[model samples]
Target chain A: MSVTTIAPPANPVERFLRTDRMPHIWCPGCGIGTTVNCFTRALIDAKIDLDHLAIVSGIGCSGRVAGYVRLDSFHTTHGRAIPFATGLKLANPKLQVVVYSGDGDLAAIGGNHLIHAARRNVDLKVICVNNLIYAMTGGQTAPTTPGQVVTSTNPYGTFDTSFNLPHLVEAAGAVYVARWTTYHVRQLSRAIAEIFQKPGFSFIEIISPCPTLYQRRNKMGDGLDTMKYYKEKSKVKNGAPTSEVGLDKQGEIIVGKFVDRARPDYRELMVNQMHESLGSRFIDPVAAECEEGEPQGCEEGLCS
Target chain B: MNADPRGVLSGTHFLDGDHACCEGALAAGARFSAGYPITPSTEIVERFSSRIPTVGGTFIQMEDELAASIAIQGAVWGGAKAFTVTSGPGFSLMMEHIGYAVMTETPCVFIDVQRGGPSTGLPTLPAQSDMMQARWGSHGDYSLIALSPNSPQECFDLTITAFNLSERYRTPVMLMMDEVVGHMTEKVVIPEADKIEVEPRRHTKKSPAEFLPYEPAEDGVPEMVHAGEGFRFHVTGLTHDERGYPSMTPQTQDKLVRRLRSKIDGANRQIGLYEAEGLDDAEVVVVSYGITSRVAQRAIELARVRGIRVGKLRLITVWPFPEQLIRTLAKRVTAFVVPELNLGQVVLEIERSAGSHAHTISVPHAGGNVHRPEQILDAILEAAK
Candidate 1:
């Protein structure tokens, strides 16, 4: 009797990814892929219409995520992803816009945009994968590099104070804020799904590994060793004040869903303020333009 | 295509060039704009912010020029005719994003209300100094369309043309307006929507399976699909293949860059727009654009009374340089008298095109002010000699 082998079911997340574009440019043992895996899972769990999802990225290793995902993606210039996504979200309020980029791309070069987008509370979801170094440019010192970490630009260890991303964005008025690691895939994916359902500027900072340049140069071991460290050191502190959650070299890692509150987003304020001032004369242009309203999401709190 | 009637203001109004440009954008169906407040150009956005609410669109004051520049591109990909306004300093900050727009073939407009620059030299003064920058400001080998308007009426008219060109070509179009035209108040008649022409975006007719994001039609321009259109297209600043995936090979680079340039260059005959007067029997031809063109017209009049057979060629489409016209004009004319607010920017192109056939005289101005008609009249007289 001839034995027959049946192929197991294809991974559900594969449908969400552009597997043909793989193997991605990411290096061996890079945690970016792991974070991407979680993001795809989050997209599945959220049950968002795949057609209505758009991903924008800036220049960096993490910026390459736009190419790997099977969504309407844009790989824009460095430091402008948030504003780009802001325009995208405002132009077509029905689309779920997400900005995926790295610490250097977001916190260093794009810091102003990050704060302003949060301040306006534009309806966008930003995923910042902080690897503590600019891994794409051969490990330059990033704004989020821990004190005393040796990077390519800082041979004697970095003396610059790092950004507590959650604290910064929370203070800037992001309605939802969270922190997790590549190790906490389940929890991180859940947090990402939550941001999709929420309706304002939401941010999640994922602590990922850069074994090629960051870990090897700093003697922090490889990708597996970094995961071991995360498992041992991470403290699951839900509702922890953002100010106390700063990362450091060989220190406690705080990871959890930190801030969850409601505030009117940029679009809401624009519509509400304009409607009150202009009265019946004002029609929501996006709504007025669409004939069938097939991609409809503009009608929220317009009359009231 | 007919414009959306809701956006049309449909009445005569005494308006500044900046405000008229805003009305033109609305009439042309630009529902999104992002800008930062910079002098001269700020009035464009100031008018837009208040007017857009009534028109049913969105206007944002971004954190800076960099944000403003890229934000409009985001809106363009999201299925809206979009633009951003800025002056010299802001325009300089927007160069990288301009390159990004070109690389991705994102259709949009950038309005640079020209001012004295090389760094914030004069905030409220006129200068045509940005003409060369408008052509080659962004780093790369690429081509773009730029329109220069001399008055508030043309400002209102050319801005609509800019939007149509951007959509038709799927490239960024620059409206290179000087501070004089931007701030000058004049009579501008707002035509009804039925009278106005707008180009609807070239969305693909092919199904998602047959569409390749970067594949060009016969015109060398690709059709666009908005973000939520189920096409799932990818656009990147990196050199890309027909599928919109990054293909870093030099072969892909050569093919992509060549197409970017050839699309605009090959359409030179159709893209070139100018007003030529007395060129049939003229010894000297005066070339000018923007506010300088209005000044040159006076100079041409003065030269005619002085017995110099002087003609006028007022440029409306400044980029693509109108080289073919200049080459043809050179064969008949003795010399070309080029007067501009800047110190000899466009004159260099005149010299190149008129090589060995005719003399090219540049009437340069440092530009806090317009050229006195006498200054250009003397150049015309000298060119005739």
Candidate 2:
């Protein structure tokens, strides 16, 4: 029997994107572009209104994504995109807030915000591009950089151990946690599509290659070479542990969905709690006598 | 009693500096506060968190100082005057974002109730060591408006003034208090809130669609529109254009940086808020701020009774440095006595502002104890003789 392969529908959403800016700032072989492509595709696939979406990012090469996007964007201070995005989400819950940051941004300096947002299960999507080095700062050590990896700050070999991204997100109680590399473009795109559709704090850590920084220093050569390496090494698994996935100089890369569950979103919980506490305040009473009173500044309007 | 402008009730109440700062912020029309509790400043957050919810506002205890500072900025962008309070270590963490706020022209307030520092030096003790740091702690060459309140009442009053200055200039205003002022309790008369003059943030008269986030107006103050207002604006830490996009050209960078620096510096006359006591005929003047200013005031009074011609110049706004006032005061006073909890932080500014004409003395201390009035009085008598 003959089988037919279908192409992705001519993405009508490309009209909303700045295609001219592409082949974005990521190194040619870097996985960040694939992840970004997937994200843009997911936004298109979900049919989210570009005008109503706000992309917030912190300092790093990956953080620069906000600038290239054709939407309301905020390229904020280093390690602060998550909280800034959190404020944006809380201030206007109707706005779709997405945080795009690097491993050093979300895992190191911004670790506290990452974990707390997950714990609160804020209704936002966080796309953490894990390049395993401080790419923008000339390949310095990052929280996710593997032990003994050589970089600008740790030329003699880093003594620091790497963070297990999926485990950390799960431990932080994120409602959705997924892991994918740039090599698996279709799968990463699908994961993003599904994550964006689900509510609560959805976290996806994209294991991207930083050819100019991490790759060159580690003798990983150029971008295409790194992409080839990712394609050869990554295994798209669902529940595999980081410990089970060994990091070999030329070995397998573990990538896939790790956790997905239904959980109460932050805004919904906040509104529900408000109604419970302020009972009649939220709902009009049917058997109450009406009386004239001084005009009160609407409190509900303030939240928006 | 004078009619209050902010509607604060008239009543004498004993309150700590942290509580006073919170009250002051509320009276100033600050509808948002984001902060993480640290030594000496935790009470401010605790008080604000409970009070803000009742006043149709919001208070968030952010994960850390960086988050707190960014959250405050977000709140400001969400159309509410905002503030965050921290101390020593937290202040260090907030410096970068503070610089971002300055560059982006976001109007907000930061209350740094300084303890001994370098790194968490005597977290619960009073120290004026952050004075110079407050002026230049942020990474870039930018002007800042920082106020030092000497007492709980002033803490309440200056916090309101800090918000006003921040709004007027479209810059982050710092309220530099100390452990002494933060923790000390005193009788503060809560004037009818209406008696307090509140400065509403200047928003563009233009429709949100036409608002330019960083264009300077005639008075150097720009109008702001919050995010989600359908005004597509950008804010960045890098040197940015008038439209707020990052710019690499030297001329563009120069224009952006100069306007940011000059807006506050050129408005020094309006932003330089200070109190001068007995300056007309005094031979010796004590220049002090924060908790140290209280000691200076007492010292000046003591010196006057002792037949020493001593006066006081209390710096309400520490940055913009009150240079012109100090330079004018320098020409008349024989000597300047600077009493601070830190080892000569503000004294250096006083000396630089005083130039070679006046003899300047620094009465420096570094820990839990404060500079006693006698110590400053002795300096006054010595300078008088």
Q: Model 1: residues >4 Å from true position, as ranges?
A: A1-5, A291-295, A298-304
Q: Which residue segments of model 2 deviate by more than 4 Å?
A: A1-24, A146-160, A214-222, A225-233, A239-249, A266-304, B1-12, B207-211
A273: Cα error in model 2, Å: 5.7
Tens-place lDDT per residue, model 1, B10-86, is 99999999999999999999999999999989989898898888877899999999999999999999888899999
What are the models' TM-scores? 0.98, 0.88
Top TM-score: which candidate number?
1
**Residue B194 of candidate 2: its Cα lDDT?**
54
lDDT (tens digit, per residue) of candidate 2 on B1-385: 2222332535788998989988888788776778898998899989886665445456777888989899888767756678899999999989988898888888899999989877968888888888787889888789989998988999898988898889888999999999989999999887776577777768788875576667889877778876655565667777767766666799988888888888888999888878887889989888888888777778888888888877778888889888888888899889998888888888888899899879998888875779878898888888888
The DockQ scores of all candidates, in the order shown, are 0.86, 0.26
**Candidate 2 falls in which docking quality class?**
acceptable
Residue-level lDDT tens digits of model 2 in A1-304: 9999999887655654546445566666677666767888888787776655788899999888877766677889888998888776765555678888889999898898989989889888889998888987788988888877888988998886678877887788898887887777888888888877888998888888888888888888887787788887788888776446534345677888778888888766765665577654542110110111311212334222
List model 2's recovered fraction of native interface contacts, to 2 decimals: 0.31
